[model samples]
Target chain A: MKRVLIAAALSTTALTATSAAAQTEIEFWHDKTGRLGELLKEQVATFNGMQSDYVVVESQKGNYSEVLNAGIAAFRAGEQPDILLVFEVGTATMMAAEGAIKPVYEVMAEAGADFDADGFIGAVKGYYTTNDGQMLSMPYNSSTPVLWVNRDKLQEAGINPDVDLSTWQNVGDVLDQLKAAGVDCPMTTAWQSWVHLENLSAYHDVPFATKENGFSGTDTELAFNGPVQVQHISTMGEWARDGKFIYAGRRNEGGANFRGGDCALFTESSAGYAGINAEAKFEFEVRPLPYWEGVDGAPMNTIIGGASLWVLAGQTDEEYKGVAEFLNFLSSPEIQAKWHQDTGYLPITSAAGDLTREQGFYDENPGTDIAVIQMTANQPTANSKGLRLGSFDQIRGIIDEELEAVWSGDKTAQAALDSAAERGNALLRRFEQATR
Target chain B: MEKRVRFKGLWLPLLLVMPQLLITAVFFFYPAGQAIWQSLFIPDPFGLSMRYVGLGNFEFLLSDPFYRASFVTTAVFSILVTLVSMGVALYLAVLADRLIKGSGTYRTLLIWPYAVAPAVAGVLWLFMFNTRVGVVTWYLGVLGYDWNHVLNQGEAMGLVVVASAWGRISYNFLFFLAGLQAIPRSVIEAAAIDGARFWTRFRTIVFPLLSPTTFFLLVVNIVYAFFETFGVIHTITSGGPQQATTILVYKVYADGFVGQDLGSSAAQSVILLVIVGILTIIQFKYIERRVHY
Candidate 1:
């Protein structure tokens, strides 16, 4: 009798759920996993519970590349989700996909959703905006590269744990000291191309590509082979030869070494805090990414890494309204603040950052504000705004290969960067022609 | 009288072969035709816009130094994987055949690695050679020889080759063991009675009778190394360390799925198809001539 009652209860719930078909379902496909995935699902549930007209469903589509590919494939088949999470490098590809996506601003205007374009932080907003200041996509889960120091390892190397690593010169001196003190891995890095070449060009206020890093037009060529980038890579190469810097794999393979207390320093995404804080047995600190002192506008700003939510085209009016409402919910101060605290991603809006500070979250967790400060410290110049090149994912593969050549001593920095630029420009030309 | 069975009517024979023909058309010919068609044009990411280039992609790829270099790399990788896997399997099969006791258990143990997927096998090997926490890397460090496959080209190639071959050894071993067991005992006994040594008898008698199996495995293993080892390379090296391990198939995946350049990827697949076709033809026409069966 109890089993029959349970089955009857389930049947009733299913019937009620079918009867409430008035709730327009909004499908959101993203690439977040682990704690972040859970938090995203929680936000979706909260949004669903807070309203009667909309029910948001979330799905994981593997990593960033997989998500983009899946989105494209689905779009081709006329079965696309309401929203897609595309990484920053794919901005150009998404933008050129003319009829495949609906701009976020248009969605807001059509649905009469509350959206203040100016409320978003300048650096983060500028990445996904056009020259006429139109937002293309909703910014979400953005982060910048920073320096992570293993405090225990520093002290063991006879160096002060509080030593300032603001400048590359000071970091070099500390690396020498750590090497002399018998440390095997003085420094290591993840996302070598991002932290070394792309971010280095932006932070030093040098162009990574011509035509304002491809924001102005698609006919741009790579300019990262310039003197500034070459010098930075050359220094890293020298350090690799000196045993002061250890070369890891192309991606975040060094995170394991650093978290295991085998490396003294790691240059990785600020979002790495979510993993490092939970796994590290030793104390660690986050610092602003170092810059060279001699550059004219050194330490200007670091661009964001991580993905943003883009509204896809060809959805019903009701579904679009649901999507717009969900996006608005995501941008609210409480939700954004909680997300920023839970993950190390930057809060998209100034109101969210202010709310976190007012709640004393940053005070309780020191160094949590470094990414925001570094991003908003200066008005982003044309060079520092962000890269928006076509086929940038492939271009980054070329850059990774060239960078590996430099690290392995197979080629000098200048030669490798030159080859990378030449190869990357070929893909850029192909992109331009195909889009045209 | 002829031993071959004769069909009564044309319609019956056609109906009997319809399922296989349908399956082949859907699975093989359709995709191959689509790849050829797509290779002639460049399609945008959404596939809504397609511009005809008329062999432009092939021209560009033929001129690319990196693509040309990958051809050489694939040649070296497939050759090494085929030789190593086949050689080791043959040696193990010979040893297992010589065992009088517990041979069944030995054969079962030798066949276990065939159960592992290519990607899983790659990860297992990667964990052992990882620079930071790898047990073998640590041991090598203690022995005063550092093993950093991430940076070393030769080491990267060697590691991927071994990892690709490790999973294939089980498959080859099973075939070799069956082929060895099928050899008639009377011939070996007669040779032994004539005062012939074990090495001479095996080389002259057993090897000749095993030629059919050997030739078949040669063709299959070569094809396996060329096509199916992509998972192993992708999981282990991702065609890295300056594209040292970038086999043709891995390049096809990187360009098509990851890079989103469908036209170039299609063109590459067509080229790979032609290469494999030529390889199979050469093997059948030349290598099969030496087999007695």
Candidate 2:
């Protein structure tokens, strides 16, 4: 009689808890921490408040690599969250994971969610799409590299505030002038290899790899150590030797140096916007990443840097419906516009950009629109759609090492490039064989 | 006679040792077995690729010039850091042992660094070593050290070795200090009474007594230099300036996690294991055998 009473009480408690929870909780895993983290929480609250059946619970994973690693581990363990934020580079890897991910288009169509692929910026959209434009992921926090200038430091060095440095040639003169005027640090770059090599390749309309920079196929070869690449790297090496371009450690160790107002010019991702905006006491401006004027087809559009939200496979129809609805809510113009304005990430859609413009947010913040402009200014060639090689993250490390060698005067540009290409291509071939 | 008979009995021995034996086989041998197996197979990032080619990863590593170069660098790094740290730790431990006043405080303070997490230590070292805003860099500039790890290969290696030693020295010092305390004062007093000076007493008496500790430290420090230094190195130099300090473990991480060449990375790990195994065997067979204690 006592055991039956206990069982009845337990059932009553479970029923009450279920009634309290009424809504289905969908899990969201992202790499945002601190301010961006807070913004996401706010967004989640807004969505939950608007809905009666779904509650999106957001979790803060670690930085980009940690988040990616966590997601991959979770997927393997069959405990992956409903939505996973995979970086832009990992899009290829995620796409190629046969049944691991359900493309966003399928989910949207199945749930009849309101989404227009045509509303997204072409280049930003292209990075996350197949050649025929089946959107695989939703581009979130899209940013391209740009030149961040400390105008106060430039002024301190007696340089004109309006000095044009749209090209590397002009920047070289500015660097020399800053040096002559005893500027301790004239120019420093973040993601030294990425900003200097990868974007430089795109800016010069050169391919970073063969086979459409690995977008079309697996058997791709690195073409980064080519002549144009060599010249740019050698020039940076000369700058490092000259004390103009300081060799900071990898992983944005120089961000602090730049942030401290010790450096005049910084080449960093547009995603650095939030950090820079918060820290910089001086007047700062964003300009297009300078290209070498001598190169033909110079000043080509830059590619995106931040991650996108990939819809994972192996979910019930209701879960898929939840994902579609959540994504549709995330893509609404009001939400996207606010996200773009708040985080300084590019508004992923034209409608979002138009909303921001109509609201005069762009007028209030001038260079906030530069990332969008840089990414959307041109029609993306196969080469410029962005890299999708199987082992790109590893290849980036090799390029980083080779770039370091150049900076330290250990190797000339051609030597570093040749060796990197040789070594990197070996890995590619091995990757190709292994993947095959 | 009864204990000897029990030791000789298989059932008795097996019952006593089964847990530890099983644990070792399950954990250590299993990982070793898996690493060996993985070295034979290649892994692709996507689930698309899983191919086995016998001895392919090993041959590829052997032929690769970059791996060869980093292997030698790893050797140089491991040896230099182990020796320097052991020497410094021994000296400090001896000095602390001899101090009459505030000895406990000194010992406690010295062990404080050992309590710090390795990840935290890496961050602190990076902050101190940073070129522009680093306090140490400014002081070095004032003192004419010409030190900049990011731009110079030698300096980068120096920074890595120093940071590795700094992170590891406290634990080593603790061991040596404990070993120092274990020695009886009467033996050293006898040496002194025999008109033996400090240097002679240290060399003939104290050094022999500390042999076991030194041997233990040699093996431990070398392993620490190989595995633990990678994080701090990655934080500070990132095997940079010119790939000057990219050691074996850093290469493993870069290849396996970042590069996604799990098979080749396993091959590198296998090679590292073999190299460490050979070194450990040599130490046991030769150096430790010759030690007095």
- Give lDDT tens digits, candidate 2, residues A221-294: 88987888888898989998998998676668778878889899999988788899999889999998888987
lDDT by residue for model 2 (B1-293), tens: 12353346678878888999999999889998999998999866544457888899999988988789998899999999998888888999999989999999998888888877666677787678767767898899899976677768887798778777875788999999999999999999999999999899999999999999999999998988888887787777667766688898998887876666789888988999999899899999999876766
Question: What is model 2's interface RMSD?
Answer: 2.1
Query: Candidate 1: misplaced stretches above 4 Å?
Result: A1-18, B1-9
Leading candidate by lDDT: 1
- DockQ of each candidate relative to the true complex: 0.83, 0.60
Please list the Cα RMSD from the true structure of every candidate, rounded to 1 decimal place. 3.2, 3.6
The TM-score of the first chain in every model comes to 0.96, 0.94
| lDDT digits (tens) for residues A325-383 of candidate 1 | 99999999999999999999999999999999999999999999999999999999999
Write down the worst ten-residue block by lDDT for model 1 chain A. Answer: A1-10
Q: What is the lDDT of residue A69 in candidate 1?
A: 93
